[model samples]
Target: MRKSVLLFVTFVLFGLLSSAQQTKISEFDLYGCWVLENKKRPSTNIVTYKLCENVAHEDVKFGSKISLLAFNESEHESTGPLACFTTFTEKGTWEFDENSRIASLYSGHEWLKEFKQLDPDEYASWGSPEKFDKLKFRVISIENNQLTVEIIPKQYGKKRTEDSLE
Candidate 1:
């Protein structure tokens, strides 16, 4: 009876550990328009992954009080204040690795240039992509239509900042 009880306890502990190790996010859950919810400034920051079907490239639309930038194959017109804002549009791609839990955004130089203009200090510090061409983030969680990602600092080889989106 003592041996049986010990085995049962071990099994329960193993089950709990395994369940805790399971990931909360999946690749399929990442297909949508994720807007930056915790922006340092009041701006429109959006990242779309497979959001629009039949489109060649993924979409990333970021707009500030001064400028608006888009990375997409199709033309996306923004009316009102966004239209009047200085605009830059292009094509981009994105990918996700479930094993590493990394989401990579391959928006080009224009996006980076505009991003630098939007926040020069941030761009100088950690916002600049180590690879120059791709920005990688580890998907921390996806709950209640919100996605939280932590920037994977490639150059500094450390974790930098978190970006929450909904």
Candidate 2:
């Protein structure tokens, strides 16, 4: 009876350890449309990120949406025509690093030129490539159909290098 009890305890301990291990996130796990949750104004101006096989340009009622395609291409669309001076459809590329859990997005448009042409005052205020071209985010977790990411701050006086998703 003691031997059987010892065996049962060992089995239980092994099971517990196995359950404690975190599962690694794969590209397949990120293959879906995820909407950004706005805690302050949940119903207003919703931003969405769609990481899928194809890019779909859907109209948003309030905010903006970005579609990350399978071939590293991206499309961005925003509402509030007067407020947003940028083009209705902006093309870009995205990269994800599984090891570091870092995702980077590189916009294909010359935002500085566009902003200067559209709104000179706004362009003079904020028209840097650092502000408009590249964005990096560290993925915290994806749970219960929600993706949580933390913005990675840009490093000053250093050139940013891109990492390939593997």
Candidate 3:
């Protein structure tokens, strides 16, 4: 029991340290819930990607001196004739670099494949084997209540709004 408690405390401290290293997002105005618009259908030459219904719901909160950002993605609907493909749902903190306009997202302190619950043959197309622990984004623009970010690795565009609509 003592070991577990110490490990948990260490893990939490690591998260805080990393978050402190990056530029604080409080300088900007991303402090609200922004729902992703449009269905994302990503594909590669070898594997086909399926639409994960009810995709992403992101939230950005602020403290007196610190900021918090969290994103959760889920709702993997099985498509007909495709009994395979890994489910990619990640949730964690986000770090931003205002100078480079880059936002790096960090998943849980540690990644466990077993936590994903997948078949031996099934492979995740999106945020799978890679653990998506540090997904980066190049901020194209964020002004006047508009957010346009291009995800790295493939540069997929994602636009969000404050009105809850596309």
lDDT of 2 by residue, 1-166 (tens): 9999999999999998898665567656665444433234344322234332233334223333555577776666644458664556666777787887777777745665677778877766653453344667767677655556666666666666665221
Instruction: Give per-model TM-scores.
Output: 0.48, 0.51, 0.35
For lDDT, the strongest prediction is 2
Worst-scoring 10-residue span by lDDT in model 2: 44-53
- List candidate 2 stretches off by more than 4 Å: 1-21, 41-64, 78-87, 109-133, 160-166
User: Per-residue lDDT tens digits of candidate 3, residues 125-144?
Assistant: 43355444355556665544
Show where candidate 3 strays beyond 4 Å. 1-27, 39-90, 110-134, 154-166
lDDT of each: 0.52, 0.59, 0.44
TM-score of 3: 0.35
lDDT of candidate 1 over 37-87, digit per residue (tens)? 222432322232222332323233343111112332222223345556455
Estimate candidate 1's alpha-carbon lDDT, on a 0 to 1 scale. Answer: 0.52
TM-score of 1: 0.48
Rate residue 156 of model 2 by lDDT: 62
Q: What is the C-alpha RMSD of each candidate to the true structure, in Å?
A: 10.7, 8.4, 19.4
Among all windows of ten consecutive residues in candidate 1, which has the lowest summed lDDT?
Answer: 64-73
